[model samples]
Target: MKYTEEHEWLRSEGDVVVVGITEHATTQLGDIVFVELPEVGAEVSKDDEVVVIESVKAASDISAPLDGEIVAVNDALADNPSLANEDATGEGWFFKIKPSDASQMDDYMDEDAYKAMID
Candidate 1:
């Protein structure tokens, strides 16, 4: 798993990459109440706003961490936004994308670096 400065975590699962906010991000966002995910098959560029999260504290947009095609989304979020708070890096994953350049992942932080940054 790799982590972006924006607090998004990416885990490569075979050919696709799974994306979700970090526990630190969830803590900052307070309790999530709403989530708006991008459509499957949408082409996205790195840094593009892809998911909208509305929490009790504030609304935030989760950006794409790499250029890719959105292949799947966690539909469960629409019904229960709190899933993000319950298991941010697991069941709360926002989307899976087939990256245009998988090497783009090399630029992100490893767990140790991410922990240092958060600390």
Candidate 2:
């Protein structure tokens, strides 16, 4: 339930998985303007490119933290990209996944490890 140096976070909600950028990423990207999300039912691999978040200064590719099939996407980001920057870990979530390999979750960092990487 933490993030990577690349700014992606992995959180599990029952069998579903949630992915999004970290607060650090938002700060670095500045004011976000657009978020391009993958379609539901699309398959994604660990570290695969799943989204594109555009900011006032740059556009960043949001990668997946584990291998999974996309089940849901945050359509709200299309109308309010700032939400990602405002609360990257909460309302800013980009996609929900149903992991193709549930055990792949073991490859991700824990909260302390993720925080240290960003700090």
Candidate 3:
């Protein structure tokens, strides 16, 4: 898994990369109340806003972590936004993207580095 400075986490699974907000991000956002996900099959460029999350404290946009095609989105978040707080790294994942350039992942930090940055 790799983490971005924006507090998004990426996990490679087969040919797809799964994306989600880190637990620390959820903690800062307070309790999530709404989620708007990108449509599956949409092409996206790195840093493009793709997902929108609304928490009691504020609303935030989650950017595309890499240049890729959005292959799947977690529908569960739409029905129950708190899933992001309950299991951020697992069930709370936002989407799975098929990266156009896998090397784009190299720019992110590993878990230890992410922890250090957050600390």
lDDT of each: 0.97, 0.86, 0.97
Q: What is the lDDT of candidate 2?
A: 0.86
TM-score of 1: 0.99
Q: Where does candidate 1 have its weakest 10-residue lDDT segment?
A: 77-86
All candidates in order of TM-score, best leading: 3, 1, 2
What would the per-residue lDDT of candidate 2 be over residues 31-81, giving only the tens digit for each residue? 999999999999888778889888999887878877878999999987899
Residue 94 in model 2: lDDT? 93
How do the residues 11-70 of candidate 3 rate in per-residue lDDT, one tens digit apiece? 999999999999999999999999999999999999999999999988999999999999
Candidate 1 lDDT over residue span 1-119, tens digit each? 99999999999999999999999999999999999999999999999999999999899999999999999999998789999999999999999999999999999999999999999
lDDT (Cα, 0-100) at 18 in candidate 2: 88
Q: Score candidate 3 by lDDT.
A: 0.97
TM-score of every model versus the real structure: 0.99, 0.94, 0.99
